[model samples]
Target: MSQLLRRGVLVACLALSSLLLPLLPVSTVAAQSGPAVTTDKDVYDFGEPITVSWSDAPGNPKDWVGLYPTFAGPPGGSSGATLWDYLDQGDGQTVTPEGTLTWSQQRPGQRDTWPLAPGEYTIYLLVDDGYEVVASTTIRVTGDTDGPEPPPEDEWPANPSDPALSRKLRAMTFNIWVGGTQVKFGSIVRAVRKARAQVVGVQEPGDNLERLANRLGWKHTFTSDDGYTNLISAYPLSAPKRSDEYAWLRFPGGGRVAVSSVHLTPYPYGPYDLRDGASTDYVLFNEGTHLEEMKSRLEALSALAEAEVPVVLMGDFNVPSHLDWTSATAAARQADGEDFVRPFPWPLSMSLAEAGFRDSFRTAHPDPVQQPGYTWTPGYPPPIGDQPANLTDDEVFDRIDLIYVHGPVRTMSSRVVGESYRNAHIRVRPWGSDHRAVVSNLRVRPLYRR
Candidate 1:
């Protein structure tokens, strides 16, 4: 071969070697991995602030961590939308890696707490590394700001000595289910008259105030923009005024006792359609507005009760006082300090407990059954049962109706008239209303004397 041809071939070979060297993976480039972003804490009280942290992703860091909140769920499942925007994107309130991110309890002032109900929420961290996302450990947020303190026990009149006072002051909470066509006016009249309750706080009475009061032979006092209505007996009651989430009824029992009747909207657990099955998300959202309004009203009522007189708050809270497992996914998502607004029940119940009022039903029966009781009865539509089957053994559904007492009233004994529709051993009349009446025997005593 000629020398020139040989040189040309050598040059071509050298060029090919350089190209192959560039194609080969470089040894200095290490595969990136590390401990996931770590939160300083897992659970936090609603309204309180919290901070989260993480070891920087081992890569060419492109952007700070962005947050997308899910309403709590199993990993890789159908989750809700992102609550807040990217956390560190200079959005005025961005949290630095060293600086802590704070979140308030599910109450007034907090951004995400607007539609405060009670439930869980999950916080997901997405680290922007230019090439791919590096997610951190999931943070769980709970709306239970009040902690584990149980409601105050029903206090019977400090001075049972005052028998006359005890007998004269009677309190009760009734959910009239105004939406139901079967809720006859006569039945409500019969229920109130039979109970002989002096100050009654009723819920869902629709717009039939005059007719209901006339039929029952009682004077009407309170009403709300929503269908919630209330009436007080025994003393000349003042006109009803709207408060936090109720129609406040003030009765002059020498000192005064304020009775609030409320109808909180249901919580939303899922999309509008899946409400029949596992859709607590939808229920929380639906009911959040009512809960928020009720919270505001209750706060006002609390202030009034503190200033003027003792309070014997009673009404249909329309929320079960227990942890719900089906909505746990949604509940965890609420924990992340995101700008998402959703509804939950536990948070509201926690707020009420913190406000110094006692749940009369819980106090009356310490170890009440955890399942649904007293409120829901079949016949609403699909899923809840269309026709009434055996009244006995039928699942007692939805413990939404409640009676709560505050101030100086001593709760002696409280029970649901038809707590168990089906007692295998005994027989009783069917519950008058879809919601069984919650009756309590209270002992009222003058403050300071006892």
Candidate 2:
């Protein structure tokens, strides 16, 4: 009995030792093998230098680190680096596995003075001069100074008004889907008020135009016979003799302008067809019909365009702008699912441009790469239709709703008003509509008849 007891004790001790093996010191095991990066501080005072440390990196000469403002788009070279430094300090020599580098606005090797501004920024350890980030960390710089800090790098200068242009106007194009029946109407009212838009061109009013205008206390409202398009304004709007597409808007100071609200056919949307790998010829063929529809609406206003009468056309065009579909936008597949639909000369916008109309949002923001203002469905109430089963709930995002300006109107400041600041240039909570709204601060010059 004693011999059996001793044998059992030995067996239990061996089992216990095996169970405790993993709990031993980490030094007894191999270190984790992969690139790792961290900043000495997560937050810093304005103008303070930043120190980033890294370890277990590939150590290639091209392996580098970049500091980018969070609003500067993705980490790739598309936005360009605010500050960058290679592990070898651009000496074309390999570097050690781990080290530290500091940047205080002026990049190490460059002579130009690129001061690190106060804002949220990210640090990335990338390899081979590419966007393949081995590791990354985020840091914020607080504006601790007494005076106010400047706007972010992406912010457009506030209404760079041309000296000759003085009559100020704020206009908006909103498509309150199905009269915003899905959400509370007060939210829509709040959205318009938040935009501070004096003149609004509305689509899908759906018997709610009067209610909306009454709620906002706007004096004038125009609704198409078919209820497809509508207009509401603080200024007086004279109904044209026999037109549903446009109305004469008279400002308090005697400036006269024409405003049009149009909702183009949503059937056979060009962006989705393009995404389905449809040929350019097919897409343009469909757009040709859209072009005809647009021609019919603007035909009566042709002389107005020629006469340099300021006309603001706002609507859900149901198509992306030609200016947005460029080579720079093509380089980045937005959010991974969207296809590269660039260099596409969308005929509708091209026709509008030929008629001397400029996209108000694009006029305010010239760089498509810097700001791809996607005002289409804001990734809510996912697309539902006879779509392919393989298609995800949220697929494509493009700027389909638009505000176009003709004649003497100058788009001063333009921004997208949507559910959140992440999705729009301005945030109007309880966004109410699936499609975001485009609002522009415009300066309209008075038209003097010859």
TM-score winner: 2
Per-residue C-alpha lDDT of model 1 across residues 81-161, encoded as one tens digit per residue: 223324443443433433334443432221343333334444444444231345555554455334333333232212111
Instruction: State TM-scores per candidate.
Output: 0.49, 0.60
Cα misplacement distance, residue 172 of candidate 1 (Å): 2.3
Worst 10 residues of 2 by lDDT: 153-162
- For model 1 the TM-score comes to 0.49
Q: What would you estimate as the lDDT of candidate 1?
A: 0.48
- Superposed by TM-score, candidate 1 places the C-alpha of residue 256 at a distance from the truth, in angstroms, of 1.8
Predictions in order: lDDT = 0.48, 0.74
Tell me the alpha-carbon RMSD of every candidate: 13.7, 21.3
Give the residue spans of candidate 2 off by over 4 A.
1-164, 226-228, 334-337, 382-394, 448-450
> Against the hidden true structure, what lDDT does model 2 obtain?
0.74
Clashing pairs in 2: none
